[model samples]
Target: MKIKLKIWRQRDSRSKGEFKEYHLDDVSKDMSFLEMLDTLNIKLIKQGDLPVEFDHDCREGICGQCGVMINGIAHGPLKNTTTCQLHMRSFNDGDTIHVEPFKAAAFPIVRDLKVNRSAFDNIISSGGYVSVDTGQAPEANSIPVTFEEAESAFDAAACIGCGACVASCKNSSAALFTSAKISHLARLPQGDKETSTRVVNMVNQMEEEGFGYCTNTEACQVECPENISVLNIARMNYEYNKAKVLAKK
Candidate 1:
């Protein structure tokens, strides 16, 4: 297969960027998107041209490090598919593919398709953890978490913090990401101790990072690679409200 790629090329965050077109020929339909990029980069290197910069790690789609806008869709046209998991078969021969970074105020372009997603790390640093004491591992039966609660927590914990939710939102909100962090812990018994404080602090940090407010458009949930539900946002709001009300008492 062959495709024409119109990729965004930026020298750096300070440099002006624009689309540069390149033709990729004889691409295997079985090759993953990132693998196709590798092929392109190899050709660029042989020609003494600067290669397109993108992020990828654990290309099996577990790390969530591989993410970008393909034809204006986060991770490409496939639902619940990360860029690393996207294959060339999704596109036809002679297709003109538009590649760009995940656009958001908090995720400024660093170079080409690479954006600085450290804003998410900052939010997690604020309060996305448990403050448990250091000790030997506890027995599994000691906590007695219900099956339903464990499943719910697992679902929320599945979020990889890829920022797809932010990229997909018209307002560039991080509600789904922030809420998943809140919900994962809120459902677990060990997380109950800091649930109230965690929600408040995380939300505050999310806003401070320049992410827009959630308007319940549900676009974030739709584009999330993990399929994280918007329900987590509601859960976070409820927790925040409850925390605020209790603090008043």
Candidate 2:
């Protein structure tokens, strides 16, 4: 299969960027999207051209490092899948694939498909942790958490912080990401102590990062690779309100 790629090329964050077109021929349908790019980069290198720069730590979709807009959709056209898990067979021959980095003011382009997502790190640092004492590992049955609660917390915990939610939102909101982090802790017993302060601080940090507001568009939930729900946003709102009310007293 063959496809034309119109990829965004930026020398650096300070340099001006534009889309550059390249033709990829004889691409195998079974090849992962990143693998196809590897082939393209190899071709470019042999011709003494600079290779396309993208992030990919674990290509198995767990790391969430390999994310970008493919044909205008975050992590390609597929639902709940990252770029690394995307296969070339999803597209047809003669297709013109538009590849660009995850776009948002909070996530500025560092180079060709790579963006600085340190904003997420800052948000996490604000309060995404449990202040438990260091001790021997507790027995699994000691906590006695219900199965439903554990599963729900696991679902929220599945978020890999890829920033797809922000990329897919028209307003570039980080609500989904924030909600996932909030909900993951809110559901767990161990996370209850810091829940109130955690939600307040994290949401405040998210706003400080320059991400736009959530208008309930639901786009973030649809594009999230972890299938994180917008309900998490609602949960965060509730937590935030509760925290404010309690603090006022």
Candidate 3:
């Protein structure tokens, strides 16, 4: 099938970006979205044109490095699917698809479909660590954790920090991502000692990094690829407020 793509092109963060259209023929419905891009890039390279720059470490979609806005939706139209996992079969023949970088104040455009997501690293560094030393590995039963909490923490930890939540939000918020990180640790025993400090510092850092406030739009979870629950955000809020109130006392 034939497909048309309107891809955002920019040389750098300081440059103005625009959608550049390309028509592709003989597109296979079985091709992954990134694979489709690869075909386009190969075509451009053969034409002596610079290939479009996009980031992807693991093509299996676990790295969270390949995220692009497709048809104005973060990670495309498919729910809980990463860009690397989206297949051309999802679109009809001769359809026009718009692909662009994730847009958020914290995630400045790098080039083409790549954006600078280093702000997420800064936010994690702010308070995403536990100072406690568990030393060597312990026996399986040494620390007993309930099935519910363990599963919840595992789910929360599935977040790859893809920033789709920020791009999909009207406010460009990172609350979902931040909350997942906070809850992943907070649910575990090792992170209990630093719970108050972790929430306060991470929240402060999120704001400082220019991520917007979450108004419960929930576009984040819908596009999250990992299906990370927005309940984590509520947990983050609870942890933050509880920390503040106790700090006052």
Candidate 4:
């Protein structure tokens, strides 16, 4: 199969970005999206041209490091699919694919398809901690947690911090990401000690990061590669309110 790619290229965050088109031929439908890019880069390197730069680590969809806007959809048209896991077969022959990085003020473009997503790192650092109480392994089952509670926490923990939620949101909101981070900890017994403080600090940090507010548009949920529920946002709000009421400033 052959396809036309209109990819965004930018030298840095301060520079202007625009689409540069290139034609790819003899692409195998079996090839993963990144691999197809590898083929393109190989040709570019042979000609001494710069290759398209994109983020990818582990390439298996577990690590949220890889993401891009494909044809105006986050992670392509597949629900809960990351760019690295996107297969060329998902596209038809002679199709024109628009490839671009996640566009949000908090996520600044570094170069060709890569964006600096360290804003997420800062948010996680603001909270998402268990104070390492002795580092000694506690006996499993010391605390009685229902199976439902455990599963809910695990589901929230499924978030990989891909920033797709922000990328897909019209307002560039980080509520889904923040909520997942908050909910997973709120659900776990280990996270109970600082739950109130955690919610407040993380939410504050999210706002400071220049992220927009969630208006329940549900775009984040539709594009999240993990299929992390937007209900997590509601959970986050509850936690924040409870923290404001109960937690000591």
- lDDT tens digits, residues 1-249, model 4? 998999999988999999999898889999999999899999889989999999999999999999999999889989889999999999999999999999999999999899998889999999977777597888888988889999999999999999899999999999999999899988988887778889999999999999999999999988998999999999999989988887564
State the lDDT at 33 in candidate 4. 92
TM-score (all chains, Cα) for each model: 0.98, 0.98, 0.97, 0.97
User: Which model, 1 or 3, shows the larger lDDT?
Assistant: 1
What is the TM-score of candidate 2? Answer: 0.98
Writing each residue's lDDT as its tens digit, candidate 1 over 1-249 gives 989999999998888899999999889999999999999999999999999999999998889898999999999999888999999999999999999999888999999999999999999999999998889998889888999999999899999989899999989999999999999999999997899989999999999999999999998877888999899999999999999999855
lDDT value, residue 26 of candidate 2: 89
For every model in order, what is the number of clashing pairs? 0, 0, 0, 0
Which residue segments of model 2 deviate by more than 4 Å? Answer: none
Question: lDDT of model 2 at residue 158?
Answer: 93
Off by over 4 Å in 4: 247-249
Residue pairs with clashing backbones, model 4: none
Ranking by lDDT: 2, 1, 3, 4
Which runs of model 3 end up more than 4 angstroms from their true locations?
A: none
lDDT (CA) for every model shown? 0.93, 0.94, 0.92, 0.92
